[model samples]
Target: MGEKLIYMDHAATTYVKPQVVEAMLPFFTEKFGNASSIYTIGRESKKAIEESREKVSDAIGAQAREIFFTGSGTEADNWAIKGVAYANKSKGNHIITTNIEHHAVLHTCQYLENDGFEVTYLPVDENGLVTPQQVADAIKPNTILITIMFANNEIGTIQPIAEIGAIAKEKGIYFHTDAVQAIGNIAINVKDMNIDLMSMSAHKFYGPKGVGALYVRKGVKLVSFIHGGAQERGRRASTENIPAIVGFGKAIELATANLDEYNKKIMALRDRTIDEITKKIPFVKLNGHREKRLPGNVNLSFQFIEGESLLLMLDMKGIAASSGSACTSGSLDPSHVLLAIGLPHEIAHGSLRLTFGDENTDEDVNKLLEVLPVIVERLREMSPLYENVKRGNKNV
Candidate 1:
């Protein structure tokens, strides 16, 4: 048998499911048509779009008309934040979000600040949790919108989204959540959560990349972020991506159908991996709340090691993992999420995220549990920081 390549980077992206590919194949060839044209082929494409919209909406317990396809989760996030910010600018210039939000929401908020909007970035606890009380405290008369993520991308800390949403509703402020990481892993209901706007990406689930959606609650007004055609009810404009939309719809169906079973199985492996890694590796710390995180997430920080060096070593062993958010991997900075949760810069620099997927088995977990301790030990021996610590040099 060939050597196994354990892929543990599901948080970064998941492989497209075979079912999803089968669902999308016909659309790419025989059914190829612009969703905009009024001809027969075009009508078929339009029908597929609407069907996909319903599937996605149903998965999230949202209405069919509320779903609008976008090019990516980032686009959905940008449109949700900037669209709401600009539309409600007359209502108030203040917005509230957490300090640990994904860059899509964070950068958009920063851009709005340049346009004279006031934003309050709430801090998280050491467990990477933002309390409802903290959000309630941040509310002001001028606060118009509150956008927080459903779950953290790097640490996998599931936020109190419904609680925050309730606070936003009671204050009459629009609530939006970047659910890119949370969509397929947990249940989401826009109505129960009191969410006015939300974002999702297909790639996070077992679907194709470069396709995502924004959920706008009916009666919530959003300014158009993209303008050209009448597609997406004139709110978002572009020719709809038909094949990817079909794959997204099918993927959501599969993910929803098997969510409970998948979570139960994956969480077992995840917990076992966490326990073994922490017990075997001294000076290793797990990030995020122990119980209040995604089932597949296992984030850890190894002392006296650089995360990139660790990733390279793991790659040589044919295991795939991540140091931080793939979006910011090329950057030199330590994860903002880790630093926000009280990890010292040096400690944060050694963080690793081994997010599991449906395909990850106990054997894979065992392989990691076996290899990781050895890698960390080897790395620490070569680490100058470890040497300093060993020599009783506290100043370093």
Candidate 2:
């Protein structure tokens, strides 16, 4: 057995980088002060928070004042959707979003629907790409907000946010994006995209987990999500999590500063892994848009095998990965994203999400390639459907 554990779940969350951890230590101890206080310690804390705000703003090409901190990406998503909807209900009642959004966005939209707000869930193409025309066509006279994710969490498909934003801007509708998975991976300019609001989680990009930010464009009106102290310009209120905020800022700075290099390296490793797995494995289907997907994402389905079984085998081999399967959820329903992309329930049941990250290497890819086919083969041998197919009984 291999002594090292191979972690490839970056999309879920990243481990904190050393520098970011170092940047946070002081605030956690000696410099610990409530940012809302007026004392010298409080001023120091306030300064750190403001500096972090500026760093986050600079990373995304937004003004510092436009950034509001939240507890997590889910909070940011909830806040953005509900905040805009409540604040602008008089303007309109319809909201537009895609079918492949994370549960945060999807559930929030459902909540809004219960509140009598109309929402249009747009469908994606076979490649998991939502077209600009689809978005434009979905817009109604009552449409007040367009919320889309910058990238798909499971499939890693990058949406046409700039185009979507342009469409929303043309119609004078508010455009927001859940960019939690994309902030460190892609270039973002709020003004150029005409995005009214965006949500990002610090943990997704090597920062602390409890701190995130929501970008509300200048002049955009949104109701407060957290109501208490006068922190975060009264948008979100609580004593700021200063250490986590500092860590978040440092993480963003490091990620953006080395973006190009990181992309090149990670993409190379990812592509190598994908190519090797696909070429060597039989009956494998790659999900999502090949060209427009995230650099480190490789989602695939192996026919006639269960994803949970494969995940268990990988775990035994010290490889950490994710699988989307009905059995895993103790439900008969397959992954909504996979099914939406035209995969049959059986195929969707076998889906695996192998996301690469900073620590993955060519050796890790090769190790996965070496072990995965054997596991698939072993699993398939026990699968009745696979056995039937092998005996030339396609109907099974």
User: Each candidate's lDDT (Cα)?
Assistant: 0.93, 0.90
lDDT of 2 by residue, 327-382 (tens): 13455467788988999989998988988889899899888988999999999999
Residue range 226-319, candidate 1, lDDT tens digits: 8999999888888888999999999998888878998999899889988988889878899999999998999999989899999998988889
Clash count for candidate 1 is: 0
- CA displacement after TM-score superposition, residue 394 of candidate 2 (Å): 6.8
Candidate 1: residue 193 lDDT (0-100)? 94
Q: In candidate 1, residue 82 scores what lDDT? A: 89
lDDT value, candidate 2, whole model: 0.90
- Runs in model 1 deviating more than 4 A are 388-396
RMSD of 1: 1.7
lDDT score of residue 75 within candidate 1: 97
Consecutive 10-residue window with the lowest summed lDDT within model 1: 387-396
Per-residue lDDT for 225 in model 2?
90
